[model samples]
Target chain A: MESSEAGLRPPRHRVSPRARAYWAVRASAGWLMPVAAQVIWLAADTARLGPHVAGLVLTAVVAAAHVTVMPQWRYRVHRWEATPEAVYTQSGWFNQERRIAPVSRIQTVDSERGPLEQVFRLANVTVTTASAAGPLKIHGLDRDTAQRLVDELTEGTSADRSDAT
Target chain B: MTERTEWRRLSGRMLVIHPIQELLRAWPVLIGLVFAGTAGGQSSWWSLGGAIAVIAAGMLRWFTTTYRVSAEQVQVRRGLLRRRLLTVPRDRIRTVDVTANLLHRSLGLAKVEVGTGRTDRKDDAVKLDALHVDEATRLRAELLHRTPARRETAREETATPSEVLLAAVPAAWVRYGPFTLTGLVTVGVIAGVAGRAVNEAHLDPGRLGPVSTLLERWEHAGLPAEIAALVAVLVVAVAIASTLGYVLAFYGFRLTRNTLGTLHVTRGLITTRSITIEERRLHGVEISEPLLLRAVRGARCLAITTGLRVGRGAERGGSLLLPPAPRAEAVRVGALVLGPTTPLTAPLTGHGRRAARRRYTRAVGLAALVVAALLVLSWTAGSPAWIWRLSLVLLPVAAFLAWDRARSLGHALIEATLVSRRGTLVRRRSALACEGVIGWNLRRSFFQRRAGLATLVATTAAGRQRIDVQDVPLGEALRLADEALPGLLTPFLDSADS
Candidate 1:
């Protein structure tokens, strides 16, 4: 929390509270693949494979730890703010990053909702510039908030006539 | 030139040239087909039929492809059944490359490639396969917004703006070639092809030149002697190959600033390549010296231009302002290309001891992790004890590299240029015009944050498109960003008291 306030403060606002549940479910869904592989290994139970119960146990421990810890960490780390001049975002839990793209250089602004996100009444907003360093993505926003953000970003970018590059 | 709306098919010369080119390409296959026909005692008619099919495919391309250069855009329509149309706006055209092989030259024809800086799709470029020399020159000149400038290579040796020469690599510069491993790569490619050919033909590789002698002697030679001989052979082979590659690619290299303002690069031996880069599209210059090249005091200079692809295999092809030459020469050419103020020679501000400590930690930590893994493997698998012992050598090397890498970490702002230098193995110093930077990224891993360091990246649309000054103190990173573009970061920062 202190580092989030370090030098440059964290962005002005957080995403929708429901994003916690969405991320928890998403993290669990990702953990399923490794869990499924371990389950299959345990079920197959080949003696020659040698004491493979360790694999299942290790996977369960890591998967449980990841699914429980990651969602809260991400929600705490992710923050975003947009103004007439620039868009700023702080993302990632362990490897944190802050990106600043001037409105004059913004090439496109897009908003979309996946099937799960729609069920959760959530959406994602992406603002990109011509540079290949890539887009700024803010996920787990309320659908209305995302739509408003997209519109506001569109308005800000269109008002600036400079070349994106 | 008046506005022209009509679609023009490729030069009629392709109809004649295509069949011969196709026949040449398919000769080995055709020969196999003939042999198979003879062995099977089938009619020889199918061989001629197969050859005709190859020629037909080639000739079909000539018939199907048509293009038109309008006032607003250049459009190309091609394909028999697919009917694909590629259109690029004239104003978006960044560079024009004209190429001609010996055959094309004999026929007085050239291939024109129009680049629009679009990386959205492969082969989006509009290429006219065979155009008459004069027409290609006129089109290249027009596309670049100029009358064809006189070139050492344009017959129209073709298309350069009337220009002032910037720098030309002399033939003696080829002495620097052996230091870089470009020739080894060429030899690798050649060896791969030769290996495939030998496999397919079931031929003996030993019969080729001195290879048989080496193979015969290898049975009698001791291990150390054999290694020494092998090393000597490899050294000679690589040096010879790279020298040949240097001569082939940069034989008549000339960089010129044309009257129309674009930079003109004309070079090649058997197959000539002329590339024109728009002046405004150029963001900066990068001077690179790989470790071996550094030992030899050799370096290469490249343009950080928006449209051209550089680095990897593309490094030798386009955006290269200077080939492997003396380090001083590289900087001189870098200054010449960047113009006026020479940020290329500016002294960079080094990150303090903390950044150096971080580099050592990361590098030594990585080496320790590798040793631990090897230990685990050796214990479980009962591998040779010497393996992990041998791995111990990497620890000292890693520490030395960490020291060098830390030494390389520095960034500075000189006049209007943002200079950043990094990398121990391939030390790259780039001087970017601050205006080319479109955005900024300040990143920190948990360890980096704990260490109070940030990797500040300037995201641009040119060259690699992102340049990083890694492991500077977070405060220094913020200050650099603000200084590079004074008010750009000020709006987003919250009271910069570090």
Candidate 2:
């Protein structure tokens, strides 16, 4: 772990290793939607394109690329750190974005574990503020880690609120 | 304080004025029905019955509504069957505005609207449709001044008279009207009215006698000449309408600041308006200069105050501390509104050459994308190649704009205030108190990272919520956050040795 003195640029922390499997499941679900539509079109006689072989091939290639390549790339790019002062998140691949939410500004911290995430023991933490830019989402953390982060954030914010007024 | 339990009705004049206003609103529908009935050869009795029903409903509504003001809250009870008792706490009240249209003014009545900070709910405001002018003014003062005894004591201690900040004369309208987009807005309004009139008339050009003859005369003149004439007429009409609108809206405009820490703005020629905003609630000031207004060295000043959640239209009409005036005058008023020591015209620190390059790249890329889209469209539609060739001229213009935008982006930390200036077409300079900043947001995209730049947004509870200093160096952004609010970011700073 990097020293805490890094200020707003906290040391990069990766999500749980099972995040790759979780992403694969999500990617397959997304790919199946278009593949299913293409299958319906191929079976339907009234389809305008009339069973496009090129389109089918392109779709398969795109889906295969997403399932195989995207998860690893995402894992490399996704980094988050929760300190006493702020929550830092660095995400995205092509247009990588780093965001910092000061602890004092945080209104609520919520941890949600979905059914798919339950299998992998993963959870996502959302930090909400009054900002119009919407909530700050920290995805793919271990369930226990997410819970501890939430508790830490809540405690920090509550301490700030008493002194702020 | 004596316990008052009686629920008082609005001024009796509302019974007459409300029904008349309701009838006026139904005029369009009544006219449409009349036309429809005449065309179908139906009786006029149906239209007459509809008018009576509308008037009866209006009267019933006026009779049923009643309001009461207690020490703790103001309650308005309305509706006979489905009664709604809206209770607004006395302390929660933020603004009190009184407005009077021609009819209301003639009847010595004004509409009093009490507003709280909550804007998400439509019914959060308490509106008394009609009240005696004197009573409205008194109520406005009472609601705005929460503690009357304290205000009186404070006023007596200061003993300072109200100072006039700005008063618009007829000549000021002529000087500022053309600089604003009011002419464009007037043109849009004229077009809408004309379109609606044409639809209602349904005049067939082929069967029309006078209109066809005029069309023939126009045809005798070439189509090009006819189009030119139409365009010239529209321009003249819009200019005249805009000037008239400016004169009508701000003929008797006045802005005054009192010792009681309240600002009173009274304006309008036909429909008079009185808006009161407390100085304590004011967060800061913003000086805005649109592209056209900037050309004329004109600017407008607005107050960034909390708990003044007037609707968009009302905000434009009321929140203006300084209307389209000289840049110097706007700055002067802005400084005055902010307080004695805070100067808005201080030199701001410019973001560096890397920011300029980033802006230029983004601007040129966007222009190129547009040109490419045009070329593709022309190729697919079999249009002339010159269509896209003409768009290639946008590159130089885009470069100039990007350079201008980069130069304009600046931020300054002046004592306890943070001033940020941005925008190419509508330049805005906002000065916010550092104490008001509740949080800080730091963002850096991939391009920004390569350029060593990031955007620092200061989140506050006042106007716009977030004020961003875009494309500043990453280190500078971190330094700004730390300086603006100490101890908040220091804990996370990396050790120097790292």
Candidate 3:
């Protein structure tokens, strides 16, 4: 929510609950090639240790872990906050990184909703700076929330030219 | 101002100098030609004729090339068939470097190169080869002179002609040379050349009977002893080569603060170079202490300035303010280069104990991975067990280094300058002006989050874009980002909510 308090820090908000489903879909899409290879290996009878059985077990374990465990853990760690001054994001599951892009330093703010995300009414926001450390990405936010954040950040950046000094 | 319209030709002596430069550049080709002639059973006169033809073409080019300086721009017009006219705006000119190789020096001529800060292009610099030394210097001064408006403001400062800041003597070479890898590099270069020459000459090892016999005699001393003797010889050779190379490169190294608020560095034994850099363009100074150099308290200082990009095949020594000097002297030079107000000796605020723990874990993890890889290799590739054993022994050393590296990591915001120090093997201490910083980046890994740590980075336009303050608490990173650029982060601070 937009707060009237000028100096008050913004509260960290988690991404949309549909983020888990989005992540699951993305992970499964990525595993397509590996799943296909495992299937071929089992069908070809090239496996040594009851190969089909082992491959099926491994695939199930990985699919289950990605669909059930990873997305939830990722959702818990993902947090972002935007005020008039700067945008802060805490992201990543394995190497949780916190990134801050001051409104004045932001070069661009982009919000995108993919076909899958649109189906779930989810969007992603990317705040880019001239920094080599790369852009700050806030993933799986509600579509409207992502739009508002982009508008606020872009407006803040446009209003402040003094930071260039 | 009226004199600027005149188009000028390089000194007539360029006919001689240009041809020599061309010949030098094509020497490898000429060498290859001679070998080809020998192989083809052709006359030596054929090679000589080819070399002469190349030199004549170079001389013709010298005669055709011409340049002019206009009020607002400098223009170079050359090429007979495909005439190229390159015009550079006067205001965009960043540096004027005058270089003279042995032949040019002997002929009292110098090659003037004007850089415009567009380092990405190889032909970004406009070069006037074989100009009279005095003419080159005058041209350099005329081109680099500040505009009248800025001159009026700097009048008080320009009252002094030029002040000598630091000068390198013969003793400096000895003091700094061995600590650098210059010797090892020289050895490698020499080996490469010698190997190539031997291959080209089709030399036979068996023909050197005495040398082979001497090697055979040494082989009886046992492999370990023989290896020790070889290493000892290599070290001695490398030491001699490094010192010689250092002396040759920086025989008369001198740094001067000129009247135009610019730094003038002139150095070299044979070729000699004069590099001029405007003081305003300087972003900061980087003091680097390599692992070996750190042991002897020696360090090098480089100007982290815009426009002076360290380009490949270009003279990178332009940014070098101080070569190998004692750490104290290097820091003093760094302060002097930055201006009298900046003190490099001030205490730095270090990241707390969590930083050390993180570093230790990272180091141990890395060592463990290496050990694991070696173990796997020993099992699969049937490698020796001793390799893994040696890696296991290095774990403690790795831990110690990590702790040292963590201790070295520090950041301090003093006035308008932010000083950050990092590294263990090659420690670098950089002082960047707060105003120069364009953005801030805060990063945290899962392990870092568990330890309540974050890495903060400040991005600038000059030198390395990102300077990091690693493993500080997340809260501190937020505060630092705010403090470094006031009002930039304050509007976003969710202090009450957090």
- Per lDDT, the best of the predicted structures is 1
Q: Native contact fraction of candidate 1?
A: 0.70
Tell me the lDDT of model 3 at A137.
Answer: 91
Q: List model 2 lDDT by residue over B63-174, tens digit each.
A: 8888888767888988878888989887767667789988999999999887665442655468898899998987887676656456667775446545566444446546
**Least accurate stretch of 10 residues (summed lDDT) in model 2 chain B?**
B309-318
Interface RMSD (Å) of model 3? 6.5
Please give the DockQ score of every candidate, comma-separated: 0.57, 0.36, 0.31
The alpha-carbon deviation from the true structure for residue B118 of candidate 3, after best TM-score superposition, in angstroms, is: 5.8
lDDT of 3 by residue, B1-498 (tens): 676688899899888777888789766556656665667745456667878888888988777788998767889988878888889888877778899989999999999988766443666568888699999998988788756557778777657666676655447446678778788978997798766655655566556999789788887999789999999989889878877887777778888887666888888889899899877777778888988889988888887765576533564667888888788878888888887445367888888888988888889889888999999999999999888988898799898889889989888877677788889988988888777777766666767767777788887656666678888777767667678778776545565335
Residues A1-165 of candidate 1: C-alpha lDDT, one tens digit per residue: 344335577788898889989998998899898888877876787764655677777877888888778888999988999878889888898899989988889999989999999999999998888888857889899999999999999998888876678
Using TM-score as the measure, which candidate wins?
Answer: 1
Task: Give the lDDT of residue A39 in candidate 1.
Answer: 70
Rank the models by TM-score, top first.
1, 2, 3
True contacts kept of 2: 0.41
TM-score each candidate. 0.91, 0.85, 0.81
| Candidate 3 CA-lDDT value | 0.78
